[model samples]
Target: MKVFYYLKHIGLALLPHSWFTRRQRKLEQKFADQQDYIQRRVDYYLKTAQPFTLAPEETTAIADYTRRGFTSYFYDLKEYLHYFPKQCRFAYYFGDETHIEPRHTLFKARPIAGDNERSVIFKLDKRRHFRFVEDTLSFAEKKPMAVFRGAVTQPHRIRFMETLFGHPLVDAGQSNPSETHPEWQQPFMSVEDQLQYKFLFALEGNDVASNLKWAMSSNSLVFTPKMVFETWFMEGTLQAGVHYVEVKDDFSDVEEKINYYLAHPEKAQQIIDNAHAYLAPYQNPDLEDLVCIKVLERYFSLSGQLEK
Candidate 1:
């Protein structure tokens, strides 16, 4: 798929230079259409025009970016930069630290709200974080219990995993082995394995829950507390009960929420449907390219780079 994206980008480069510029102009107008879904997302991601500039030495050419992190970040960003010179400058971050706030850099995670202006989001590490599953099991066919399998490295998840790790209604366990809690260690379960259950946990780890995009795409109902971190998925826009069953930060309400949904399959199915609808737009590769291009254009325009 990455090769196909590269070939398509090379194909686009053969078109007249004006074609790319015109495409960007049309998309900028699309971002202005207040009623458009794409516009709403663009607005949320890049709320205000943050005018800034970078010294030549401070900027790293996108091609020259170190590939120590996921090489997938390079592929995702460069796919949209075929029109620009290889030396075009960009700043980026590719790590688990959620506090990353560069003046203008491509980053994976950002706060859902408050003190977020310095961060500019792009779909970095998309293959890992945003990959969706093809869940065929229906909400009714799956078991009533919820399942969770991940490292207990995040502060938010420690208590939940400790308290409910052995609960009868859940199959929760730590996948990453820990010397402190060797008893809770279990083999990793694929997204498909978790799909067998009617409720899937989308607990936040370093930033946003890495399993969230795929979990929401599945047939099972997702159980999560309120989201504090967001990526390209717009976690803040998700309403409790409509997209997923909201649980208390503690596992205080997990069983109650899961039992309610088990009894009301219709309500569970509705949340699954809403989740699929939310994820539908992101499935398109062309739309992804266009949105990324619009974002890059804004970064360049506001930073005084496009003027050159």
Candidate 2:
């Protein structure tokens, strides 16, 4: 297993740049298809709700790529922004983060939405790859430790994992190209497998951790570093210590925090309960549909396209 893992990484490292480019193109196509499917669903819901009534002239055709094929994640901002109208009242962005200058009217969406101008609106997690767990283990039945499985995309994540390695209460690893254990060949844990643990570590990669949403749905207490990024479900709304345990950005005190939680099981349990309560609303598909409707209505209103 270890040999296979290292060999795979080595093979990729030895491959030419074009190989990765082709692989990325394939991934982009897959993401585009998923986004289109979600857009269809949103359209159906909007039509059913009849959230806004607009005349032909009042119906502003915002350049929405939600149903079109375009790279939303890890895109070239300058190149992508060129496709949007410069002086439009509002342009919707489905990318991971919004990079358009405040002078422009474009807004970011998905994962985390909103930009420096606060024009971006929040939307539910749209990636079809996420595994949504309807059932989660109780805190008492969960493993009394923390676990993280993801790619090592940023240096801070690497440092964080290194600091927590070999800790008695922490069980962490990489899913792809295993940074911490390059030689270890372990299959990526399913979302259900991860929820069995009492504590789940949420770390950033490329953008905010998408797993954070899944973790919130579970009964486990999430321990994360100070987040510089946010997703559709803003992290700011969650109170640290109550909804989750926040470690330093550098994760220097992760061990100490884990020890504290271990000694005070009741306190940790309260945090777990709070997390479950806060995320309960998102579990409903109807609620997500309503959020989609609200986002579109707000966009239309702000863009001056909604009929009086």
Backbone collision count in every prediction? 0, 3
Report the lDDT tens digits of candidate 1 across residue range 171-258. Answer: 9899887787898888878777899999999998888889999999999999998889888888888999898888988779888887
Residue-wise lDDT of candidate 2 within 162-245, one digit each (tens)?
787667788877766764467433467887888888889988666677787778767787888766665445564678898889
TM-score of each candidate structure, all chains considered together: 0.87, 0.66
Can you tell me which runs of candidate 2 are displaced by over 4 Å?
1-66, 70-90, 103-115, 124-131, 178-181, 184-186
Clashing pairs in 1: none
Which regions of candidate 1 fall more than 4 Å away from where they truly are? 1-35, 85-87, 100-102
Note the residue pairs that clash in candidate 2: 111-231, 111-232, 112-231
Model 1 scores a TM of 0.87
